[model samples]
Target: MATFTEHYDLIKPGTDDYYDVADFNENMDAIDTQLYQAEQDMAGVSEKIGNPGDEGEDTLFGLLNPGNQPEEKADFYRYSKTEIKKQIQNWKPNLSGSTTFYGKITTFRAEKNGTVYVKWTSSDTANGEFYIYHKAPLSILEAPDQSELGSSIPKGLQQEDFCYYHINYVYSSNKGKPTTFEWVFPVIAGIDYTFMWYASSASSLYLNEFSLGYTDTKEA
Candidate 1:
């Protein structure tokens, strides 16, 4: 009795025999390696397309670290003007325009959307008033951006205006003890800001210890 052999097994040894399991496995591995390399290349292309221009460009996953893990930046930033010991007599004095910069606390930078915190100390005997004004660039103030129309700012502001009141605290409660007030101001990304403080009093309200804080969206 003769047994029947498979048709593929009839091929000569090492003569391009397609039935060789070793050759089949080698080819499969090569194909798999090519597929994997192609996938990697495609992924790199996608990333480049997502973030154009210079390297380390911005992307939808910008909030992630290098390890693909979510990262959170410290939201609180503080700047103190300890040398701001000037006394303001006018009610609407522009501190930013002053030569001393009101103790050099005139400029603050915001890289992303957040809120600004302002704090200062005022010394008044009684019936004195302290004021805080927020100032922006002249370009935005001259035209009054339409986006600022719905803002809570007073309607009395003119077109060529950069000063807007954040708040005013009359020195009636803690007269000689020196009153302190904290104000919160909303901010937008990529905008430079300066704050002006004014005090009105006959006895000369001493202003000092100017400090500013803000919520930041920058990376830690």
Candidate 2:
């Protein structure tokens, strides 16, 4: 008979280690049993340690600011329609898409800290949007009469000189009804800021409501 390899032996016609078919089948069965036991042990260990897949998911608070500070939440303060329209002489859409227009008007509110928000019930405004401008509180006080000129700048949240921001784009057709928008500008502590809004497009829109608020960052 031919001699087989020393390290591993398998049944072959001419090999010295030739074995019966029954014996080969028994060896395979034993190997399978051992493998199954090892798999179970590995699962038990994983269960004790807990799954390591979801390390950073499902969290409420996050470290957003520098020096490991937690992100802040905004505290909302509402404004009345009377107070918002006071800054604007005529709150109608100056730019008209068509000769005839329907829907309510657009209105907004400003905060001392330069935060502004606007709400509307429909998208009748030409572009279904508006512009926000800020003027220094002192400037608004001196030129109370200047409020008639819608182009005149209002108190800015960051810098001076006729700075303005835009919100909402003209939608080809109406999306959903009843929506509110918000914007934030860097503002000084004691210095008050005035916010103004004007129609971006000719579409007529109605101003439903608005608000101003502050945000506080906290550690969780």
All models: lDDT?
0.43, 0.40
Give lDDT tens digits, candidate 2, residues 1-37. 5343443443234555555787667556666787898
Give the Å shift of residue 118 in candidate 2: 6.5
TM-scores of all predicted structures:
0.36, 0.36
Q: Candidate 1, clashing residue pairs?
A: none
C-alpha RMSD for every candidate: 19.8, 13.8
Candidate 1 wrong stretches, greater than 4 Å: 1-105, 126-161, 171-174, 216-220
lDDT of 1 at 116: 61
Steric clash count of candidate 1: 0
Worst 10 residues of 2 by lDDT: 73-82
TM-score of 1: 0.36
The residue ranges of model 2 lying beyond 4 angstroms of the native Cα positions read 1-123, 128-130, 136-160, 168-176, 217-220
Top candidate by lDDT: 1
